[model samples]
Target: MSKEYNVAILGATGAVGTRMIQQLEQSTIPVKSLKLLASSRSAGKQLQFKGQPITVEEATPDSFAGIDLVLSSAGGSVSKKLLPEAVKRGAVCVDNTSAFRMEPDVPLVVPEVNEAALKNHHGIVANPNCSTIQMVVALEPIRKAFGLKQVIVSTYQAASGAGQSALNELKQEAQDYLDGKDIQDDAEILPTKGDKKHYPLAFNLLPQIDVFEDNGYTHEEWKMIHETKKIMLGDMNAKYIKVTATCVRVPVPIAHGETVYFTVDDPSVTVDQLREALKGAPGVVLQDNPAHQVYPQPLNAVGKRDTFVGRLRADEENPGSFNMWVVADNLLKGAAWNTVENAECLVKDNLI
Candidate 1:
């Protein structure tokens, strides 16, 4: 029998953090002990693991004791403070925030795209943004089958990506509107928690996510662009991956969908080639066939673990341009599952 490892889950109360608990229950990694850590406010809350109840504790620098693998989904600041401490105590951390994603030394990974990056980690590995995760998972297969040159993406993301409070706001506001009552604004956390203004997400689409940057693209958009490169290209030099994205938050509660337009270096590549490539790709499901009126949907992608892709067609105006739609559970395959997969890989390869 192999040795069991102790694992830690930071931010054990947040949406992605809670899903980390669920996924770990189903993980193949042998866990000798599980530690649930959060803010002091969340301490003493009961969380279940493998049919047993575990109390949450406030995470501090010393929380990494005896931890073999640590999966952290706490906000960026918490990671900025605790990640190094965890690593100093010899815990391998898989962080789900942007804090370490772009670090020259940190590996930004999606297991399906670049699990190998996990091996070179000096105790910390990063997971890409939820929006970029699905897009790259779908795009990697095509990138491998036919060399890709440039990509343009527009995201239709769900409110749950913001957090549980945003979801509650949407539901309450919808109920108030349906009851013919004045829909009071609880816009404390909608578009972004730290932003100056809160906009009503119910019956509305917010084009701004993660605030605006100097380049006119929101930070979320910049995340997709930079994280895509950091994930796909890693430290390797390429002229450029040539990516641009516009991220928007829609009223949906779960899953994220993307409309992507891409050009391949191989001009001979056709829609048929791309379909065949994805049909055989790991972590990808091809649901195309316009004749049957079949395609991927956010509802279908929700609660599942695969990146769904469909609506494949050649861009009529551009000879080598192609369009495709991709969807995935932003909190699952995009966040929790991917983080769990990284931890599992660490154990499988005996790195943890």
Candidate 2:
């Protein structure tokens, strides 16, 4: 851990990929060489790293030669194809895709929630879903202090979570609607770009995030349900940890917010006690103040790297039931920052 390591980012030109570079630059992790890899079309593009120019390379199986760490934000197909190639070359991969998330072998980690799981990585670690990442970071402390029993969450995700093109579509559609012009629905991207149908995300909420599953829940919802149980159980049969989720896409450009309801094992835990626990939790920013209407907002949390939680209150009918809201820069804490943090955990613990 003395000498800096050579790190490669697999999808360097995309939204979360670019933020990974930014997070690396801001991180205390000493990096010797930075390799930026994208699709063939994005190769040769120039990017900045601590003021020096770094050129993007096409992501191929041979891209991992001499690489020590591969922080990837590429899609599942790319990860499925290339991650093992990187690992074969002796590089540890922190993948930000759904490809290996639920694999019994690959550890799905949020550094704030389950850094201990890093010990089980077999050269690959999966980052949790963006919506799941923020929600769990905000709730992990509560779960530890109050004892989580049953939980429910609904997400208001931002367009930036969809990628750069989705942001453009949102802006253009909003402008078209505002000008009273004939709005043409472009079916290229959105809701799930790879899915069958695309809809206008401007001035609307798309109930679906990823492709729908046979059981009626979209993949996004399933990710939240499964990932939460995995992280909380730590190898136990988490079947009793009742969890349900509803994911919606909003017009926001950055930050994902969730309103979560949960029943704790401790009925004596007051809102004041929960507030105190969240106030001092790592990777969480507590912003609760009902009188001032202070709570987590997408606009205020766009570029920040911390999960903000607020709106703590008791559920009116159910004793021991409580509700809270959470927010975080979806691309940062939800993706890039968490990826980098996992890599840092490996290095800090000498696991790699």
Candidate 3:
């Protein structure tokens, strides 16, 4: 007999939240009960799990009463307000927003990269940014083998990472464009909802994914830079790794693709050795066979949980530095699956 636990999803009606529900259907965790939670507007909505209809309830402090685990994707503000309450109610939370990720005490985890960090969680475990999650998943094995010194990544992010509205708008814009209508009017809630200006993501690439900081880096880019160091190299060794990222919103609907350039500590490490290391890395799939023109692509990665790596090569001019292409379903391994994987780790380690 398997041990069973009661689990709740904090943002049940949203994009990643829905994916969490779907992933749970296929999850290895033994769930005795599933509670769907969302804002009051989404309450009374019925969602299915294992062919059973589950009603989404309005999330509040009391919603966590009998819950053993909380997978939160209800946005940062919601997590900021409710996660502590969930913890107070004896529920461990795996937060998928930026709310508690940088909180020193909260463990920002990508189970493939930092499962050990879960042990340090007081009650909340943070799921990293979508782009950062997939990037680190592909880079962790390299970092572990050659000792990553610096990382520079440029991301072609899917509109799905923004929100369901953004994705819909992208489709709307494309259709409107093909119909000879004004595509500009279809733009509303992206590259971010908080930004004053909105851009059409259908036939255009917005260089910014979130509001820009004073330093000119968008919040999304900064999340990758800071979160990567935190997840890949914990506090003591964080300073050893230098990370920079440029996040862009592309027309793609589901998966995110990245071109990553990284420098390792050892210059002697060759391309063949790196390829072999990635081939055996857990949660990573190596698709780098240039002869056949095979490589990881966003279309191929959609719906998959593994990080796909390809285009592996050593930078001839910069010894110790290599470039690779990384792709994954932004909603799966990047968000929902990662959240579930963290919960699975906790259960496996008997932390729950």
Candidate 4:
């Protein structure tokens, strides 16, 4: 009989956390028990898993007793605080936050792109940022078929990427705009909640996703640039690969779309060759049929675990350069599903 392990879903009350529970149920990981964990206020709430209602419990440091795996999406600070504790109690954790992603010892992974990185995990595996996740998934196959040199991406991220509260605010703002109320009056969350200014996202696009760094790039952009490098190439080779990103938050409620321009080392690479590379790539769906006007869209990508790639075209001036549009359910493939997929990889590799 295959061994079944006890599992816990941290941040069980949040958007991505709840999706983690759903993904876990759909995953192949054999779970002996499922524990839902969240903050004190959210404790005692019942969340269904495989038709069974699991009561969410307060996440204390001691929550990981006898647990074999932990899927965490609880914000960076919460992961920073609880994951080490989970590790201490012998649970292998997959974190969906920026907390330990850049840590030298912690492996920042997108299973499709870098499942091998999981081998080096010191009990915690960091999931790549949501925007970074979808882009890398589409790029990996192309990079493998033709060596990658540079990547430039502009993302149209959804309001859901901010959190449940931001999604709520977006809906209210949209309704207020239709009702002739001031949409800007209650803007408190887009483009980074802690930033000095909040902008209405009802029908507007905010170029900034997170706080701007000294270099003028928002933290979201920084994450994509660095995380793409880290996942595509190891620390030694990461610096050699060039990556840059401009992240924008659109008013859409779910799924993120990105316009990615990439240069491959092989100058002779063609659009058809790129399509062939992505045709059967793991975790990717090729939707490029411009002749029929079919392409990946945010609405169609929702609730799906696959990253959709379309609009493939060669760059006019830059030889071996191509551009494509990629979309994925930010909450599913981006956060929750990726976290669960990491756990599945761990189990398959017997790391957990």
Candidate 5:
């Protein structure tokens, strides 16, 4: 029999956390035990795993005792505080937060794009942002076939990217709007829960995702820009890849859609060539059929783990440039599934 490792899930009650549970249940890692860690308010809750009830515990510095693997999607602050504790207790952690992503020792990974990075982890691995995950999954195959030069992306992000409350708020706001009630007056989450200003996301689009930084880009946009380079090119080579993004919060409840325009280093790369590159790419489903009007959409992508890519075309204005549409479940491939995948890689590589 293969070695069975003890696994613990940090933030086991949140949106991504719950999905992490689902993904783990479907993973190949041999599990000797499963531990669910949440905050005190949610401590007594019992969540089902493989038809068994696992009691949620309040996470502390000592929650990681005897755990061999840790999958974390707790907020960044919680991760910043608790992940090191988990690491100190001898567990390999795959974190689904921004806290440690840019750290010198941490590997910010998308398994399809940079699975080998997991071998370099110093106890913790970082999962890229949801939007960045889908883009890179689609782009990596093309990059490998041709050569990537630059990327400019505009995202149609779903409400779930903001979290469960925001998803609930989107539903309420949509209903309020449909019933001719005031949405703006009760709006509090979309754009960002931490930001001062709030806006209705129903039947409308907010041009911002996270709070703005000094550079005039929202933090979410900044993540897509920097995280892409890190995942595609490593810290030393990341500066060579140019990436720019505009992230927006849309009314959709799950999955994220991106319109990406990229210039390949090889000027002769054709649209059909790009389509062929992605058709068999790992974790990528090629849905590009312009004649049949078949392409990736958020509704089709929801609840699925694969990143869907379509709308392949060459830029008429720029000979070496190409464009594509990418979509995936922001909560799954973007967060939970990626986190679980990293853990599987760690096990496969004997890094854990």
Candidate 6:
């Protein structure tokens, strides 16, 4: 008989954490037991899994006792503090946070893009940023078929990427607006929670995602630029790939969509070849049909695990450059599903 692992979920009540729970219930991993860990305030709450109610507990250093695997979606600081402790207690952690993503030792992974990288993990495997995860999935096959040289992406991100509270604010603000109530720019938590201003997302678009860095690129944009190279190429080879991104938060509530313009090393690569490459790509659903006016859209992508690709065409101005549209549920393949997929890879390889 195979071993049934004991598993734990950190940040159990957060938006992504809760979706992690849902994915776990349907996952093929033999979960002998499940532990839900969160801050003290969220402790004692009950979350349903596999038709049973599990109590949420306060996450302490000892929370990993006898746990074989951990799926963590906690904030970066919490992950930085607790993941090492979990590893020390003999648990393998798949962290869905930005804390260790750029670390030299950590593997920033999208399982479809770089499952083999998991072997290099000492104790922790980091999930790529939500936006980065979906884009890389769509691009990896193309990269394999035709060597990629440059990539430029602009994202139409959903409110849920900011967390459940941001989604709630969008709803409340939209309702207040529809009622002819004063639409206060009542900004508080978004673009970045710690940033100085908050703006209503109901009927507006924010040109920024995370707070801007000194270089003028927002942190979220930087993640797409950096994480793409990290996942596609190793740490050293990342510089060989030229990448730039503009990430924006739109009013959509579930899925994220992107327009990616990429240059392939093969000058002769045709639009048909690009479509064929993506058509057969794992984790990708090709939806390109121009004559009938078909394409991938956020409303069509919500709740789906596969990244949808459409509007594929060669750039007329730049030889070897092609543009395509990609969309996926930010909370699924973007976060929880990718985390679960990494855990599954670890189990199948017997690395944990």
User: Scored by CA lDDT, what does every candidate get?
Assistant: 0.90, 0.90, 0.92, 0.93, 0.92, 0.91
Q: Worst ten-residue run, lDDT, model 2? A: 232-241
Where in model 6 is the C-alpha error above 4 Å?
Answer: none
Candidate 5 lowest-lDDT run of ten: 232-241
Give each model's clash number: 0, 0, 0, 0, 0, 2
lDDT of 5 by residue, 1-352 (tens): 7899999999999999999999999999998999999999999999999999999999998999999999998899999999999999999999999999999899998989899889999999999889999999999998898989899999999999999999998999889999999788868887798888889898899998888999899999899988888888886247667899999889999999999999998998888888888888999999988899999999999899999998888899898898889999999999999999999999999999
Better of 2 and 3 by TM-score: 3
Better of 4 and 5 by lDDT: 4
Shift of residue 333 alpha carbon in model 3, Å:
0.4
- Superior candidate under TM-score, 1 versus 5: 5
Q: Write the per-residue lDDT of candidate 6 for residues 203-274, one digit (tens) a residue.
A: 888998988999999999888888888899977247778999999899899999999999999989999999
Enumerate residue pairs that collide in model 5: none
lDDT tens digits by residue: candidate 4, 8-78 = 99999999998998899999999999999999999999999999999999999998999999999888899
Alpha carbon deviation, residue 245, candidate 4 (Å): 0.8
Cα RMSD, each candidate? 1.3, 1.2, 1.1, 1.0, 1.0, 1.1
Model 2 over residues 1-352: C-alpha lDDT tens digits? 3968899999999999999999999987789999999999999999999999999999998989999999999899999999999999999999999999888988999888899999999999999889989988988998889888898999999998999899988999889899986555653699888887788888888998999999999989988999998877764247767899999999898899899999998887889888888887989999998899899899999889899999999997887899999999999998999999998888888876
* 222: Cα error in model 4, Å: 0.6
Native-to-model Cα distance after best TM-score fit, residue 342 in candidate 6, in Å: 0.5
lDDT of 3 by residue, 188-297 (tens): 99879998988898989999888999999999988988898889877523778998888888999999999999999999999998998898798999999999999988
Backbone steric clashes in candidate 6, count: 2
